[model samples]
Target: MKYILFIIITLTAIFSFSQDKEKEALLAAKKANNYVYEGNNLINEDDFVSAEKEYRKAISEQGTTVAGIYNLGNSYIKKGSYEEALYRLDQAAKIATSKVEKHKAYHNIGNVLMENKKCKEAVEAYKNALRNDPSDEETRYNLGLAKICAEQQKDKEDDKKDDKDKDKKDDKKDQEKKEGDDKKDQDQKDKGDQDKKEGDDKKDDKGKPKDEKNDKGKGDEKEKQQPPQPRPGQMSPQQVKSLLEAMNNQEQKVQEKVNAEKQKGYKIKTEKDW
Candidate 1:
């Protein structure tokens, strides 16, 4: 009987504790909802800074409050804090228990992505929004716009790439042509140098041709081995012969005169003897 009484007392204590926890949860949820309501009022007045504070207070009061997180994300969007807004909105979407809440979060995410020029990602976000609520005409319109923007961006990127490729090809051609011209110039220079070297090899140190100089030396040696030749401005052999003949004629005339004188003396002596 004592054991049964103790069991009853334990059951009573457990039930009281459970009820107390439920009451506390209810009070916290009520406080969080009040803060969310205040935040909404501040947002309506365009006091986003105050609204952000209230939303943060609501989240602090009840961490699992979807309205508080979603409102805070909207406040960030109003404040132009897109990265923060995306973070909070993504969190809200992940924890939201209703399709309507998910659609709102996804639709806002698409808007933020569009503002950032992420058209492709925005298209996907809008698509997800429509998946949750296919009746939303706004999401459908945004999706169409995102598709067009994404295509335009792709075309712009393709044009830029084509221009870059063309530039690369032109540069390559120019470089190749320059290299070919340089090689041709070098070859001509090398040929000119070779021709000059060959020309120099055929010449003597005195700038005369080697073969002509050698022939002149051989002629001098041959002249030295032969008879002596008359120098310039000397008498010729014919002039010497004419002078000898004249001398012989004069000697004959002198002899004839001496003989005639001797004959005259002999005749005179014979006459005396008679």
Candidate 2:
């Protein structure tokens, strides 16, 4: 009965092991210490897909060992998964047991954040790396350089955005001004036409012809705008003749109006007007 129980338990364990057979095999390789180097070799060869798979296998076998996690994060970084790199680097940092491991995780996190343009956050990460191991002059110098580049890029982008906004506002204002000018010009033209029409109405009520009224108005406007005459005696012969002809025409018009009133059965009260 004891032998049968042992055999049964052995079979169950085999079955469970078989279910995670691939993971167990990868773990065996990781325990040999060469899988990390092999994964890094694949990364150096630019075989990112294979490198990613190898790093993932390594991490699964090694759990959250700082070196494994950091290398996994680097593999993801090579694959352009910056967000995933950040998360893996974070895990590496938490599990780090030594200054070297801790600083490495911090630097990697900073690098990924810098790539993602979370500049302020990256600066903090780099600072944390420096605090862990201030002897890494290369990292400190890189941090300073990255900060300068990030700030310059941000300033350039902001300036471009501001210029674009200003240009848009100026364009809108110009368009509005053009529209206003058009409306104002249209209104002025309409008003001038309306005044001309009103003048025509007054002329029609006085029974004056358009040509006559226009000529008379032009002459009166000219006279008003001209310098004053020396005296009535200074009038030219042509001007005096024109004035006498106009008076004669007015006298004939008065007589014709009197005759028209008589024909309509209305007697004139005085002959002086006729």
Measured by TM-score, the strongest candidate is 1
Q: What is each predicted model's overall lDDT from 0 to 1?
A: 0.92, 0.83
As a TM-score, model 2 comes out at 0.54
lDDT of 1 by residue, 193-237 (tens): 999998988888997668976799999999999867667987667
| Candidate 1 lDDT score at position 231 | 77
Task: At residue 189, give the lDDT of candidate 2.
Answer: 100
Candidate 1 collision pairs: none
The numbered model that scores best in lDDT is 1
**What TM-score, computed on C-alpha atoms, does each candidate reach?**
0.71, 0.54
